[model samples]
Target: MQHQAFLDLRTTLDLLKANGELSEVSGEVNWDVELGAVTREVLRRRGPALLFSNITGYRGPQARCSRLATGLFASFRRISLMLGFDQQPSNRALIEYVLKKNATLVPPVLVEDGPVHENVLTGDAVDLFAFPAPRWHHLDGGRYIGTMGCVVTRDPQTRQVNVGLYRSMIVDRNRMGTLIVSSQGWGGHWGKYREMKRPMPVAFVFGWDPVMEFVAGSPIPATICEYDVMGGYRGAPVPLVKCRTVELEVPAAAELVVEGTISDDPATYAPEGPFGEYTGHVSEIATPRPVVKVSAITHRDRPIFRGTLEGSLPGASGENSYMSSIQRAAIACNVLRNAGIPGILDVFVHPVNNGTTVIVQIKKHYEGQPKQIAAALWGSNASSHRYKFVVVVDDDIDPGDYEAVDWAINYRVDPGSDDIVVFRSTFGSALDPSTLLEHRQLSELGAGLWNRMLIDATRTWRFPRRPQWGGERFPPLVTPRPQDLELVRKRWREYGFAGWKAEF
Candidate 1:
């Protein structure tokens, strides 16, 4: 029988704490840019997840920045812990588990009077500045209150639930300026509201289970409800509580929830940007954006605020911190599977940039057939619109094993013939340096349509050698005389091989 699911984020954190992966910090961390930078460095260095107890500049009688799960996926061991997976499991194995659960989605259960409703603020009493809104970078426009928040929405027409991870900037003590991409469903909702000349209803929830948080930020199929996906992720149904002011449901044990309405005036632009982006570069342009008016705020006592710094590629936060490429990879894999690609090892969309570069590995079947697989990959829906650079290799060439992939690329492919470039495709990445606003002045008009190269990096059939080399058949399958590995294990103590760690 499956184990009973965790009740909430606190329960999950307790499990993590018992496992020695979470560290409680009493450090009086400044909630300004300092905390953001420090937390990022800690995650980058592969330290334990931190729970900052004291946050400066917040006048509330409760704690701030109390919980954070960082570096949970930086190592194999931690990823295993997060997924309840065995240590030796490959990425493919983990993804298979994820997919299986995704298909068995259980809708969230509703409950009343959970931890998130312990405190309530409405109308004039709602002061977002009371919380420690972190000024993540030096050049940022202002403090951001919702870098870790998930915006919940339902399609006006279809009523299908959608959750988007958008950065919410604190425009004042009560107003939040939000930026969302048009490619996502949140953008679709905003468009619908504009067409009807109505304010867009939105609710932002923070401090939920890490798996639920990740699901909210993932690229789940448009047909899949994000809430149901979160339930699938946890291996059980999620428990939810209705919001006080908005007609939306949030995780029952969430630390905080803010309900609001999004403005739709084109002329009501703000001087946004100059914040550090995932490309590891500071942005220069200032653009108008939707301003969110907070009608109510509700939370658990001693709420936690989570912050992620944004910067250029491979810099500090942003792409790497947000795990955006993980979403891209998941989506790509799903597409590949639907296309009947067999023995897929893994799909990795490198961070710091958007889905520009995609690396995939699959177990090759038959001979001279890897190119057929590579061609399908080049034109696949997932790879076509976004990825500008794609590399296909065999399972022996692990996509994560960069050194081996580079070796395959060096050995295969005469660049002129092996590299195929397709042109005039839609490409819109906020972190991409080449991406610019189109002639319509609409940010969604998207300016980065150009050629994309898909390279056949697997071993080629062409020969400086035989018709078959390094394949399943080489030397009539020469077999090594077997010495019992079990015998060695039994005799290791006598051979002074007691050096192996006994912890396992």
Candidate 2:
């Protein structure tokens, strides 16, 4: 069966249910730590998507939208299904699919009306707590309403629109705060607005189509609008509706659209987080962040709130890490190929490491090719500086197979001769737990320096075979010949192993 673009969250959920990948929970749950705890357990067990029908302690307008959804993209099979693949795809296949689709840019189409405008609240009616916002983790400073949502921003000078996925905390009625990393797209826009001495007009969209969220979080080029990439993935223009208050356009079928202005006044800043981040740590301390003064709230009636469980163990398998890894891997591969780095076969960013470690497979054509690949990757635009470890292996080894990678590292590498290029004083991720308090303090002051290691595990060359290089035969690999392996595979069933299969 062919897969089509899902217009909204409900349609995506319906597809998951039809495929037997979703489960509904009728029991009333709390928006506090209880909901997050349950979701974490489910994600750990690789369980189905969850739909919480009843949420306790949420009354009045909030009670109308008591339903919440979580764990939508926990499995690779589910991700493949959402991406319109015929069957479950490997990480490399998924990355290649995105890379191919991303080559063509498709702009979004603007419309006058959408389900998000079903009810519009302006002025005093705009309450940030009207929905069931959850405190996803025990240590989080407050209830976050935008864990799975997209924040919209635009450059004042260039007029380039950017949609980014940043965690947001509800401060009060008509007020929210979001954490913008120093290197993110939205942060650049915010900096531009700050230089222009104007408040940044922004909108937070919740409960959009699954593909929309993926595009928002992916590390696309800064010049390309995420909406265009969304259209490319969907094979059609994404329908957008103008926000009631902000000048931005939001997903037409979004469940909620919060229009606001990020205040430039330092006095309006508030403590945003001690929340657990995707790096598997709660190392980020509570700090003052820019406040967003909400001007309007618009939503569909009885909307479903989508919440993502981020940080540490649960987040490793969560939507953000999974999608980011795929996009990063694709970007890393493209960067290497575009730079004319020869023999780069594949790249895999470990989901659990959150891009801190990357595995690269290459066909070694020369003696120093592995070191060259490692150096090229470190200097690429794929955020290689943040990577603590970059492993280079032969094309015969699968980068995603940890066992094979480990074997290559153990046997093919001699630490003395093989390169372990280490660079000190480089920018590191703020969420890295290994970062010392002193280092973090320095990083906060514009000196975010750390160390990076690159390991070359390619097979060593003992002697040169070419006459130009003083003709001496090189030792052959110890593995069985290709013909012998083919004979073994062909006679596997005939060898009295009826239910067994051989993997070559």
Estimate the TM-score of every prediction.
0.82, 0.90
lDDT of candidate 1?
0.65
Tens-place lDDT digits, model 1, residues 1-504? 133354455665675677787777666667677877876687566576666666675534554334443344343444456556535365556556656655668787888768888888898889888777778776777887776788898777788888877777887877888776555668777778878898888999877776765666666666778888878766677788888877888887887889988878766546555566655666545577777888899988777665556553354334243354555566677767777867767887655444667788877664444445445554553442356677788677778667978877876666866444344454344445565534223365533344556676765545345446444222222333246666665675677535564421
The collision pairs in model 2 are: 280-312
Question: Which whole-number lDDT from 0 to 100 does residue 86 have in model 2?
Answer: 67
lDDT of each: 0.65, 0.79
Scored against the true structure, residue 164 in model 2 reaches a CA lDDT of 82
Per-structure clash totals for the candidates: 7, 1
Q: What is the lDDT for 292 in model 1?
A: 81
